[model samples]
Target chain A: MLLEVSAEKRFGNFLLDAEFALDCKRCGIFGPSGSGKSTLVHMLAGLLKPDRGKISIAGTPVFDAARGINIPPEKRRVGLVFQHSHLFPNMSVQANLYYGWRRTRKSDRKIGPGALTTALNLDHLLKRDVNSLSGGERRRVAVGRTLLACPRLILLDEPLTGLDAELKSQIMPYLKKVFTEFDVPMLFISHSLQEMRLMTDEVLIPENGCCRKRMSTEELARSSMTSVPRSYVNLLTLRRPQAHNDIWIYSWGDEKLRLIEPGEPGDNLFELGASDITLFKRHPEATSARNILPCKVVEIFGSGGRVGVELEGGGGRLVSQIVHESVRELDIQNGSELFAVIKASAFRKIC
Target chain B: MLLSPQDMQAVWLSIKVATTATLVTAPFGFGIAYFFSFARMPGKYLLECLVNLPLVLPPVVVGYLLLLFFGQSGFAGPLLKFFDLRIIFTLTGAVIASAVVGFPLLVRAIRIGMDNIDIHYIQAARTLGAGRLDTLLTIILPLSGRAILAGMTLMFARSLGEFGATIILAGNIPGVTQTIPLAIYDYANTPDGDRMAMSLCLVSIALSFAVLLASEALARSFRKGSADAP
Candidate 1:
């Protein structure tokens, strides 16, 4: 879906002036609190009217101030999953899931209840009241309810922010599966960089009530290394896990990685901080870290006292952050060969 | 068995008038409550004050206003004449008086219920492709069902005990517009009629108690229905 929005709004003292045109299946509206990310979502979904602007989805104008055309939310065919599940307390899970589908035009309904219920794993809880479901279960049901509406563009307004670390991991896969299976375009909004990387390929950064930049998701993550307190986070998606006695071995591209955590048989995502990887000029004769890989430097970039070294090894690319003095001592440069040592505990399973 | 034929008529007439008044006022009350709870419009405070005027004013004062509005050579004189409907000193007049006196209580209960409903539910329904009317009927109505029942019960009880307004407008006729309170008024005024008046008072207490119990039971069922899905 292509979303085009150029709108301005003023709320008492804060002013929001955002203009952007994005065409991507998975887009992220990345911003801190009070940065107008939600305001943009609301305007696009037709819940909040823009003062003077035109917003179009897939080449059709949903809101045009010059033409006096402001489509109501129900007619916009843009679904939204709120931060809280906001499931109708009076409805059963089945009824809540089908509420949107029943209201949609017959011809416009592309997703069936049978497929959605199975995809969301809601068959067992269909007869249960919405209030009785757990937090993660409620979120899954909320996603199902929005997807069943067959919206052209789905806006997720920090859907996972309310969940804990464990529940966030549990619900991320379900969200990924539904979006990919249904092929619906989505704009994920959140303040979490990890969530942005997991859910979107491209991102729009808004700051202080203004849109600052638009770039690839990876680029945004890389550029944020210098500013974010956590530094750079290396996201790894490994597959085909095998139990190795006390530890688990997962295949990473052409190499295998040993970790203390066990992963599912199919695929699992893990996060390794750049600062966790120590680069050595020669192969380490002995070390307490579990995994050590021979890699060649692909790129070196960053500023200040810290620098990021992009390595092409261990079956894929990994970025390691080190001080400027270390870069000089190791003589790190493009095409430089080195061995990267990482502890097994450094790899945190995200999902 | 404890009363004459006239007393029995008064008992039945009280129930009829109260029931009719409650049933007639309920829909309008819900509509007005919904407006006050949700709708954004100009001059809303004025309308709110007008709707609540009967609550603070004496019931007799309300009856006098209604009498003037529906009386011959009054504001609605020509309209009533064209319809050829006589409201003065009739059963309908008694019902109108009861309804006017009880409307504020009904609206107040329902409005409080509506105010307590989270706005997100309405937004969720709207984004889910339900239109305005659909959201109101399917979501708002069912969610506020208990409150609506509570409001109806309060109005019914108030109507049963309405004395000042009915006597002023319906004139306490025998076997016609005289409800329980009007009949009690008659018995209390007559010499040596204290026992009959006391009996009617006991019956009033019993009726009010039954209304309260039935409403409580209905509210409990509503709660159970929401808690346990079908």
Candidate 2:
């Protein structure tokens, strides 16, 4: 395992009690606001000490309250990319990136300044002061700085928050590039499902200051989190796109789904909630919905009197919520062919 | 009018003592400020209060305390004499007196600057593998530049104007330990010494104003540099 953390802390009324072990090179912690996601990661990074428990990174015990061992953050060799870029305002971009790089032991250095500067496209930015960089640029610099530190694991605490869609997109690719090019492990934290889906394959979900569940990102993308059983949001990766005034047609196998939102040129994927889809045993005719896909039922799961039907149609997969009575009446089962209908407004871009 | 030789000597002596005191105390002040800014030691508040005691204590009481510690009959006197060094009633004594009176102002200004720095920056530095001292040298010191300048200015001005402590310890020995304040005190007490006293008072005010202006300029540049940085 790359990391294992079992710790408990209390902050006034909030209690952060979480325990999880991660082996994946790129894992994510997904939760809503105040879910103790940040607190958990901060503990992992050794920025915040656990009141009582243990944290081990790469099999090295960074914190063991029972043994009275709490390694300092600098000695932990775990890098942190804060939600707000904490680039040294007094230093140039180059200096900030090298601040940790220079301090890292010669033998311990894996990623060098030259490699990071190139991967992050920090050539022109090297001489610029950090305050002058745009939000996207600052985030990129923060990533580069962390990477150059040669950390065993990198913890990103909602790094994409406080950014507009355009800037987020601009910085997202660089993050992906850095993660791919560098060999360091990364634990991403975010409240946005779309961001988690984009960045991680394994996810740890936090609830009320505790890690409640650990699941694959793909599984998380399919599950409906809301209590409203009538609707369950299902996410999909957008394939080839063809724009048609106010409507963007996305290819799904031999079928095409029309999205009502204005499509940006380079949008990669989109989300469609299960509640937005209606299942028909036979193809419907003359409906106001812009999308009708012939599909087969893959699985049926029940939750609180409602049945969630997973379907595969054309080239994509979707989940739909149907009444339990309908499931018994239609005799839905695995491989039961059906048609799924989606309205024009049902699809939203994921950036 | 041109000052008499004795008064000019006093002005020069004050300048030398105050400048030396400020320069000597600044680094120590920054170190204490940095410690107070971050460390979580027990009795940290007590340490802070002790460091700040001079700012509240009467100047004569501080001088008396210093005399008890460093005077010929005090505990440190033998240790000092072992090195053939004498501090009492010398220019060094005058510098020490001014510094003790102004130490709190220096540390307070520096602490304010250190407090203004975002904790996240220090945290970031640590996670990036920079140790505490490394972070302080590269991050805290550079970022707290403005505060340090302000503290130094205040300390310098206070040292220049230091009276009660200097009189008590340095004994107003003209051309030896007597600074501008002591000289002014002497002139104010002597009959027909009014003109000289007034002239020295104006000189002191002008000197303090110049120091304040220079320090302000330095602080503004630091602010501007950070604001205009990327």
Candidate 3:
């Protein structure tokens, strides 16, 4: 199904001028915090009215402010799993499931209880009170309840936010299974790139209050095509050079120069890492490494058994992490006279 | 001591009043709560304030207000007259008073319960293709049992102890219009019936205690559910 949303809304100082069509079965709505991702979902689900726009899913008109046509959430056939799963407290897992079942009109023409509940592993929890279920289990039941309604489209609004990482990992497979098993298309919202990787193939990144662009997660993650992966972006190693659109240009070797896109013109940042590099880093002695001045090894930092070496590259700061074993075997020290490797391929196409 | 016919009449009347008030207002009360909690409506704030008015209004004023409307030649008097009905100073009038006083409490408790509910479930249900009323009847209602039950208890307690409004609108007519609270008031006014008044006092206290206990229990469970679900 193709879901379209074009709207204008303002929440206090936050303005939302977003428009996007999601064609993928599973797509991620990605953005930094307060990027209007949830606002977009709210508009889709009929929870919030847009000032102007038309939203249609598979040609069903969900919203059209100009025409004054706004479908109520239930009629829109858009299921939403919230950041917080709002299971009905008074009902048992079984009752909650049945609640969704009873609301469906068989004549409206799709799905059955047995298929949905069994798919979500809600059968065992059916008899249990919703209050007694664990967070993970409640989410499962909530998803089950929504699916049992047999919606045409599903929207998950940061559905895994309060979950611990382990819980998130544990539930990730079930979410994948639910997506595939239920045959329902979904819009998954996430702020973390790590989470976006596990959830969807298509990624829609929201910047400011609007969607900047949409692409495949792989394409999004690739260093050359996109700057999604931290390991992919180019890190400038020169002491100083010309600045362009907040990007700094640095010579890697005689021929290879890389661009470091640092966002807007005025913002300044200190200390960058090779892991933060989107593309490549290399150290060369050419008349080209001519710009590469003498450097100094500064410090090393890592977590959970990894090591990152800090260096002063020709008076400019650069960082590259090494395996603990590498640091030990290579005799790398605080003042080691090793080159801070820089590469040309490390430059990513930042849109 | 053996049960007296007066006590029996009062007990029966109390049940009748409480049951009728609950039966008539529950579906509407829950519906109002659901709407107030979830729906985007024009004049919703006005409606919310109206629904909650009784909670803050003195029961006597509420009774007085009902009397103004339901009394003979009053605003609604002619409408009920079409059916040969009279509300003032009758058992039905007592119910009207009880229900009015209890309604705000019932709706507030239920609304708060519903407000605490994540609209996600309903949204999920909608996507699942359930219609508006269907979601309300099934998921919303069943899921909010604790809050609704709490509302029910509050309504019953308020109705049982209802005096100011019941006395004003329905008046105290022993064995008919006189509920337990009214009965207690009448007996306690007489020198020889002090013991009877004390007995009624003990009964009201006990029932209120029972309702309070049930309220606490439901509240505890409500908290447990909130913690588990999100």
Candidate 4:
């Protein structure tokens, strides 16, 4: 894991109790205002100490209350990009960029100034006074400064909050480009679902101050979080563009993906929640449907006409829903190829 | 009339004393002001009251208090003397008295400035990987520049017109510790030379007004820039 944190802190009347782990990958902090999101990020970066609990980055203990280890911010190889930009007005943009870069110990340094400045398009901005830079430009500079610090993980606290919507879009692409080009893990903090959806795949959802649950970006997008578990799906999960990050990764209603070399097959890369599919008995053959996994009505569950059916598609079992009336009328018992009809469009690529 | 050598010396000495006092005490005053406005330290209220004591106390009382601690046999008497420092009956002592009297106003201005500053800015700095000191130097201080400038100007104006403390500590030595306020007092004390005193009074008002205007203008411009900055 790139970062692991469990902390509880109090400021004024607000209480911050947050805990989560990110496996050396980009993750996001999503919560509403006063949800202790900023406080969580601050604690991760060693900017604020927790009254209880512990935090570590790559197994390096940052703050451990019982062990009595509190690493200072400068010593923690965690970079933070504040929502407010925090540029040094007295210095030029170049000076602000170099501020943290200069503090990095020689042996541990990774990304250098020239490379980061070029990547972030900071060469032209170096001459401008930090106070003179616009919000977007200041944010870019702030991100670059942190990157140049050669940190193990980056912490961004609602980096887009102060900017206008258009300017936020302008800076969003740069952040994506940076994330793609560089290997550094980042913990993006934002209450806006739209912003979180656009930037990160791994989401840590907060209940009060603590992370109550975790969901992939695709799950978060599809579920918009409703109480009911969508509906019992009765078709094969399709492989398509709507299931992944932006374009979508084809996911199955039954969980079988029709694709080639999915790379490092982790169980979490795909999930066919028994709720998103519709099943049909008559096998309509000529549709542009790329996947036609065969399933039998093993059992039926749910009430008032709607029923969930269990299916065995390619060793991995899945459940689908068929109406109670259809279940009784078709006499679709243990072994019948109830044609699972899933549109390739319905499959969202979430990985 | 072209200014005489003694008049020119008084002007030079006044400038030097005011500048030295303003620069020397500025950072300490900012620290005190920030502590008073933001920190949760114990005895904060008492500390604030002590800092503002100079504003209500007579300038000579301030000077005598400085003498009680900084004089030949005062609290800091031996400590200062250990460094071959003698504040009694010197221009340095005059600067000390003026700084003490001016400190309350300086801190008051800075404290208000610190209060007016948005705490969000500081929190934002912390999220930017800036440690406490870096945030202070880079974020807090620059943002607080207008306040610092205002405090310095206020202190200078008070020091230029300061008389009671200067006379007691520095013994009113002409062309040395005799600032504009001391010089004005001396000229007015003479039987028939009110012109010099009136002229000095006019200059003091002009100087004070100029500093006040400049600081306000700078502060307004700074706030405007922050607002317009994207």
Tell me, by lDDT, which candidate is best. Answer: 1
* TM-score of chain A for the candidates in order shown: 0.97, 0.84, 0.64, 0.65
Q: How much does candidate 2 score in TM-score?
A: 0.91
Judged by lDDT relative to the true structure, which candidate is superior, 1 or 2?
1
Q: RMSD in Å for candidate 4, one decimal?
A: 7.3
Chain B TM-scores, listed for every candidate in order, come to: 0.96, 0.96, 0.90, 0.90
DockQ of 1: 0.55
Arrange candidates by lDDT, descending.
1, 2, 4, 3
Off by over 4 Å in 1: B224-230
lDDT (Cα atoms) of all candidates against the true structure: 0.90, 0.86, 0.72, 0.72
lDDT of 1 by residue, A1-351 (tens): 398888787888877888888999999999888998988888888878888888899999999999999999999999999988788888899999999999999999999889878988899999998888999999999999999999999999999986899999999988999999999999999999999999999999988888747999999989989987888999999999888898888899998898899999888999999999999999898899889999999999997777999999968999999999998888889999999998988999999
**Can you list the residue pairs that collide in candidate 2?**
A129-B230, A130-B230, A131-B230, A132-B230, A232-A274, A232-A275, A233-A273, A234-A273, A238-A269
TM-score of each: 0.97, 0.91, 0.69, 0.73
- At residue A169, candidate 4 shows an lDDT of 56
- Each candidate's fnat, in order? 0.63, 0.82, 0.67, 0.23
| Residue-by-residue lDDT tens digits, candidate 2, B1-230 | 55899989999999999999999999999999988988889999999999999999999999888888888889899999999887888889899999999999999999998898888898999898888888888888888898899899999999999988888878889999988888988988999999999999899988988998898888787884445232
Worst 10 residues of 3 chain A by lDDT: A263-272
Q: Model 3 Cα displacement at B2 (Å)? A: 6.8
lDDT of 3 by residue, B1-230 (tens): 63368876886788789879977898889988988888888999998899889989989999999999997779998899999998998999999999999999899989987887666666656655567777777667766777888898889888988899999999998788888888888888888888888887777777678768977887776555444353
Highest-TM-score candidate: 1
